[model samples]
Target chain A: MTDRSDHSRATWRQSLQGWLWVAPALLFLVIFVYGPALTNIRFSLFSFSAMSLDWDFVGLNNYLRLWSDPKFTTALTNNAVYAVISVTCQVGIALVLAAVLEARIFPDFSANLFRTALFLPSILPVVVVGLVWQLLLTPTTGLIDQILWETGLASWSRAWLGEPDTAIFAVIFVSQWQWTGYIMALFMVAIRAVPRDLYEAMEIDGASGVQQFWHITVPGVRETILIVTIITILGSLKVFDIVWVMTAGGPNHSSEVLGTMMYRAAFRDDMIGYSSTIATVIFFIALTIGLVQIKLQKDR
Target chain B: MATARSFPALAVLNRVILWAVFLTLAVICVYPMIWLFLNAFKTTNDMFAATWGLPKIWHWENFSTAWNYGISRYLLNSLVVTTATVVVELSLATMAAYALVVLNFRAKAAIYTLILGGAILPPEVSLIPLFRVMAETGLYNTYFALILPNVAFGLPFTTFLIRAYMTGIPGELREAALMDGAGEARIFREVYLPLCRPILASAGLISAMRVWNEFIFALTFVESESVKTVTIGVMSFAVALRADWGVLMAGLALSILPILATFLVMQRQFVGGLTSGAVK
Candidate 1:
């Protein structure tokens, strides 16, 4: 009886020790991730300015203000546009690239070379990517314009990152260039995981390449597609580095998104409370997508 | 699987098309960096006049100018911050992951779910509150401001990665260690840590790259020239020398060199680490 009692006590002590081991990490999560996220909710509800300690509870005024603010609207619209375009182009191109590469159309060495070359851009620092493109797209003396004029396509060449009409698109294009390869690599992992036997069975049934892709490959990687889509959407919504570097959300805020807008409001415009509102919006959107991804994953 | 036995003509045409598309993509990915590299070695006049040509003169002065201006200082700051972050993050994450995987505890699921939340926690959402907290704590504009939050943010993903890898370690190896009168710490140190080296390398590489390349937090938290990281340094450098293309390019190139080298050397680990995250 004494031995049993001692054993139970020892087990309890071990359990406590286990928790103790994880305590440090949990402390960081609570302090940095969870604590601030919850605090942001309160900050969003208050009326406060940057660098000011005084605060008045404003209820939902900041949220209300977001509805009518033109800049906020543009930022939100731009984020949505970014999400849509990034999902379609990045994921779609990745799927195509992965499917082609997996089909082994190229010899082994060539395929490896192709992947390395494409993925090189994804690893480059976002700032460098921005600076290189900025130089390439400089209005008159840039290489892009020089090439266009030499090729007799001068009419097609305007300031790519200059005009409001083209600035956002140009930013989006650069993003696609940077990320498509990384996303392609992700899909390659998924595609490679599909059982080769399934494809062989379909091939034996006289299924064409297109038919095999739809029947076997698509279903095989459906879960990855959903996860990748959610990731892409969340990423696009929170995008900052690229936009900030490339255009500073600029040529008159044409390329402004939620992140840069929030930065400007908080830092430049001294609207801390309102910026928290934007951050809150981003958080909720990302959370919703994440939850949806979890649900879909669970169902699968 | 056997290669597709198709009509020769169709196969030939397919190969031709694939080669064209692949070559175009390769050029698109590679040409810009080469162009930048070439331009970095040219005089401003040469950069403008013969934009696509090889350098007439290999101007080593561009690098000297960039380094003297601010890149060297910023690089040192970045190195300090990134190294501290990686060290702190790896240690914390390893302990946490080990506890979660090797021990039987009641709140394991809840703790895991909470840590997973960090995977999606937008850093922007925490910016305002973190800024105020740092300022109040007198950590503002210090390396700790960057390092602490980076460590905090890094813990979740690293813990997740290490935990996953730990769980895959065979149970018998641990059981035998325990039967041999080994303490938990000894078993963990002797048995598991060595086994975890590959995944640790992967996680370490990923964390290093993130802390090294991070911009937003660095941009907001540290404003002084002395504390500014490479990302901010390069931004300010470009703005300060808006038309000095040679120096700007050199600064940009310098900022990328360490990360590029790390990536090339640890390509397998980096890709493996990234795919591990995806698997979650």
Candidate 2:
């Protein structure tokens, strides 16, 4: 009887071992991620301050205010411009470079070196990239302006970051510079993963480089392209550090994206309840775009 | 000229346009860093006077000065954070992945799908709430605050990736071990860990890069200089010394050097680690 009971004990432990396998990770996600998201939604509905545990429900007041907030409108428009311009350049250039790298069309070592150099900017901290660009594009004392003046184009010197007209574009360009490499690497990896036999079949059909790329390479990595697009769009929407670091949403709050605006509202304005509203807006916007991308990909 | 004759010229013009576009992009990509590189070697006056021109004298001393400027301490801090987090995360992820994949359990699909969907949520969405939570829990402004969240958020995704990769492994190895009367935990420790090394290495390195260069959390979570990562250190340097582009660029270069070194020395391993299970 004792031996049989020990055998049952062993079986129980084995069953637990199965549960234990995924227990820690799932627990962490559930507690930190899922729990926080639920709490976020809850807080978004209430009038809770950061220091207060109990608050009255504000209902849809936060959302209603967002409809009339000019700051929110500017942030949304700037985000749109940033997203459109950055995503277009980021994806388009990444594909071209990846194709060139895959074709081995450039001189030996040159292409790989360029690929590595391009990849370097992506890994650098956004804060540092922001600072570098801030200095490079500064108005009176900036290197770019100084260089233009020296090259006999003194009239071209402009305060790139200080002008409201050019400030958002500057931030977008900084973001674009940093991300293109990452997207390029993503494209390269996707290109690399395309099975060799598919390329061989295309070559047999007398397909040119451009034709084979359009038909075989693109089709093979359709999922990858979808994933990249979705991730890029989400990343652009939540862009905070580089803009905050470079421009501080400056030149009369011209460069403020949704993320930075939300941060300032919570931390600086000390409006916790209102910031929760902003945060919810950011979340919904990101989620909507993300879901739409996934659905679009599914339709394809 | 005949229209047909112009068609050949048009095709030639198109080829020239394509090459021009490609080369123009290459220049745009390389020239910023080239500008930074040249600017790093000039005096303060030279940088101001000849911002776009060659440095009168190579002030390589700026690199030395930047090196002396607590980039060392910040670099050390960044490495410590990354290494500790990677070790903790990989070990936890490995144990979790093994159990999730190989073991039989109830609620498996529901639990797994719930965790998988959490992967889609943007992390910053919960920042305000998390900050309040962290403060109430007495972990605010501490390394524990940063480390805990990093591990917590990173675990699900890493575990999911590892479990999927592990599923492609043959089941016979574990079965053979079981037949030999080896206990489950022992089989996991000795057999499973060794087999998971390649993917573990990859996952660990990727997490390390993320934590090492992570700015928003580091900025929000740790305010004091002592607890700050190299990322914050670089940001502070720029703020404190705005006009010193030479030192600032040198500092930026210094900050990224460790991560760059890790990539260069173990590039194959890093690449393998980066790309594994990611495409799927």
Candidate 3:
């Protein structure tokens, strides 16, 4: 009985030590992340401003306001468009590019060089990317316009970022430019993991290259494709720096997204509670995608 | 493969087409940055006059002009914030991860799942309330305003990666340490940490990159010029220098240079850290 009590004491000490080790991280996360997350949800059900401390309860009025708010609608629609385009370019095109690169048709040196060059922009500060593209897409004296004129396609040269019709697309195009290579790199890694023996077997059967790609590579990397798709979609939803820096959701809010709208509401317009409402929506969407991603990872 | 065996000429043509496509895409990917670098040296007149040619005179002063305009201060701010965030976040994460992976406890899985849940909540989701919290706590407009939230948000991913890494370490090392009468702290510091070096590097590099490039927090929390990071600093600088393309491009180049240089030097670790989660 005495020995058993001593062993239980030791076990208790070990558990205490374990908690001690995790205390600092838990403290910070609780205070900053989880705490604010819960507060954000509570803040959403009221009308408050950063200018005042009072939070008058409004009972989901902010969310209802979102439905009538044309800017919110525009931002939501623009984000959806961004999502679709990003998936198409970042995932679809990037997959094709990755497959071609991994086909081993080129010399290793050149392929490595290509991979590095393509992946370079993905690591850049988005602010820098946005600013650089803003300069490039400048109307009259910009390189893009200059190139169009020099190539005798001057008629196609207009204000790429100045018009409402083109502003969102221009911003999305720059995003693709920065991200496509990164996604391609991810796909390349996945493609490399596919067994080589399958390809050899298909070759002996006289299957065309496209057929082999469809039959072997696609099946092999399907999990990665799903993961990449979810990540790309999440990224699209979270996009802010590009839109904010490039146009600030401009040409009359044509390029507005949920992120910029949230910023405007809280900081610019001083509607803290309303911004919290938007934040809550972003939270739910991200949480749902994140849950799905976790589930997929588990299944894999 | 069959095409190469059955149709030699067609194979050659296919190879040529692929090469052309790859080269063009690669050029498209890299040329803009090259152009930006080249254009930074040109006068505004030269820049507008000939978009494709070399600068008549390499105006090195543009870089100095940008450096003095606020890029220097912003660089210092970013360096301090990134270093502090990485050091603190990694320390906390490594310790927590060690405990989670190595320690025996009843609530371990519950705690691990709770921490991992933070990864799903994007920083934007907590921006409003966090702003209020920062203001009320007097952290707004201070370096902690940036560093604290960053450390908090980064803990989840860093812990996840390090925990995963720590689990792969051989348990025999810990057993040997225990046999030698080493305390848990000593075993963690002397045994597991050294084994965790590669993963620490990977996690540290990734966190550094994220903190360095972070914008929304910088934009919202710190309004003073003294505390502004490069991302926000560059934005305001761009606005102030909108008409001066030469100096603007120079500032832009300077803003991207540090992270880009690090990425080039540690390409493997960067790529590994980024894709490691997905593969697992």
* Chain B TM-score for all candidates, comma-separated: 0.94, 0.87, 0.95
Collision pairs in model 2: A21-B99, B202-B273
- On DockQ, the stronger of 1 and 2 is 1
Q: Would you list the clashing residue pairs of candidate 1? A: none
Residue-level lDDT of model 1, residues A176-277, one tens digit each, is 888888888788788888999898888887776777778887888888888889889988988999899998888898989999999998989888999999
Model 1 earns a TM-score of: 0.95
- lDDT tens readout by residue for model 1, B187-217: 8889989999988987887788788879899
The TM-score of candidate 3 is: 0.94
DockQ of each: 0.51, 0.40, 0.56
lDDT of 3 by residue, B72-130 (tens): 99999999999999999999999999888777654666788888888777888888888
Q: After superposition, how far is residue A110 of candidate 1 from its true place, in Å?
A: 1.1
Selected candidate, larger TM-score, 1 vs 2: 1
- Model 2 per-residue lDDT tens digits across residues A95-124: 777776776556657666666666667766
Model 2 interface DockQ: 0.40
The lDDT of each candidate is: 0.85, 0.75, 0.88
Q: Arrange candidates by lDDT, descending.
A: 3, 1, 2
Error of 3 at B191 (Å): 1.2
Best by DockQ: 3
